[model samples]
Target: MRRVRTTHLVLALRGLGRRRVRDAALSVLAPVVACCAALAGLTAWAGAGRAGSPTRVRVTEGRVLLPSVGVPETAAFFRIANEGGSADTLVRITARDVPGDVTLSQHRMERGDMAYRSEIDSVSVAAGERLAMSPVGVDLTVPVPSKAWRSGDLVPFTLEFRRSGPVRVLAVVVRPGTVSPQ
Candidate 1:
């Protein structure tokens, strides 16, 4: 009877030991499994365009207006079109030939016919919409180069967007008072 009791005690202790080992292993593996799951989910989300509608932006009718006699800065205009399902913001503009930082500026009319121009940080382009930049509206204020810009000269510009990334476009140089082609 004593031997039988001892054998039962040993068996119970072995079972408890096995349970402890299994619990410890599960505790260690749980976090690893969770991390793997999270990584997979993130990868899938990125593959699907970062969990939202992709932004597709196209630039057209790009023109750079040369500075006139007394004007120190020139302006660049473009017809920006967003054809995707997401909205995007034009954050920055860069030119290879221009020396200084290109800035985004807007022209607004006040109470009367008085026009006001201000430097803007960014401009938003709604999804499936077109933003046509003109001299009297939103335009990029670019620093004028010392060398003169002739009409029909092509200037390379890179426009950075918040979501759509950088877009390279060549703008045709036009005279200050001349109308650019559409």
Candidate 2:
């Protein structure tokens, strides 16, 4: 009876040893395979030819000119930089915080008359260059209430990029004759 018991114990020990070896091998192999798969996926994502695959944008500066009744429109400026290998565009501009409509406008000299025209299409930003859009002696304009904002006030504005989408920026309110360095 004692010999039978010892033989059964030895068989159980061998089974346990085999299981530990199998588990160790699987633990190492599984992570290695998973890592290889992850690397392959990342490589493929970067290889796709897309404009602004890795683009960056920020509000360089913002200012607002005082508005008067019937001239409730103000102008704001932005500086966009595209670090990607491809070019991008300013798709749209919106003021989610302000209580008015915002659109892209440019000053045009039409038939010897200086006028502002709305730009509905996206404004392109060339690769490796900075695009500056401003209001003074320029085209970009923002319409707002005449007495809505004061100097040194911060208004939330969003700049929509063609490839980078929308980025929110705080625009500082200034007097009508304020100018920021380029």
Candidate 3:
């Protein structure tokens, strides 16, 4: 009787195994495929982010000229490096110490003479591009504060962008007629 029972159990297991090999393979493969798909989706989501965002835009070689005598404002220059994957635009800049909004200006040549003109619009920065702001290029005109400002001082300014929002950077005050300060 015990041998008969053992034989019956072996037959039952053999019949189950032979029923459908495809079904068994699919049961194991379905979970693996689902897990692989989920991992792929997570990887793509992690890699997807707006390029040239505020977090990725770095201000380098930045400086602001000391307010010169009889000069109502001074220009702030910097090398804005966009290290991200998307383009961005600088919309506004401000300093509480200054009276009003900082103006974005660019130098344009007309008949071999370069003149200053207010941008009146945002300046675009391409992804992975370096925007060099200098005395002869695009720059920010910061108004003189009520207090006397001199060289070697630091001025705080908040730069706002269309996509990256606001970023605060300290600009060192350099002497007048200086273009790049370190």
The local distance difference test score of each candidate is: 0.89, 0.71, 0.80
The residue pairs found clashing in candidate 1 are none
Question: On residues 1-182, what C-alpha lDDT tens digit does candidate 3 reach at each position?
Answer: 99999999999988888777767888899899999999888677567764223436887766888887877887889788878777789999888788877989887767857565666677888877889987777899888887888788888888887777888888888887778523
Where in model 3 is the C-alpha error above 4 Å? 1-55, 180-182
Error of 2 at 122 (Å): 1.5
Error of 2 at 36 (Å): 33
When summed lDDT is taken over every stretch of 10 residues in candidate 1, the lowest stretch is 173-182
Local error of candidate 3 at 131, Å? 0.3
Error of 2 at 33 (Å): 42
TM-score for each predicted model, relative to the true structure: 0.68, 0.61, 0.66
Q: List the residue pairs that clash in candidate 2.
A: none
- In model 3, the Cα lDDT at residue 109 comes to 62
Clashing pairs in 3: 51-85, 51-86
| lDDT of candidate 1 over 1-182, digit per residue (tens) | 99999999999999999999999999999899999999999889769665567889999888899778756788999999998878999999999998788899999888979998899999999988999998888999999887788899999999999999999999999887775423
Off by over 4 Å in 2: 1-53, 111-113, 136-139, 180-182
lDDT per residue as tens, model 2, 1-182: 99999999999999999999999999999899999999888777568644336666655776666565577566787667776767777877788655666777665556766655656566777666776766533435677754467688887778888778888888787786566534
Candidate No. with top TM-score: 1
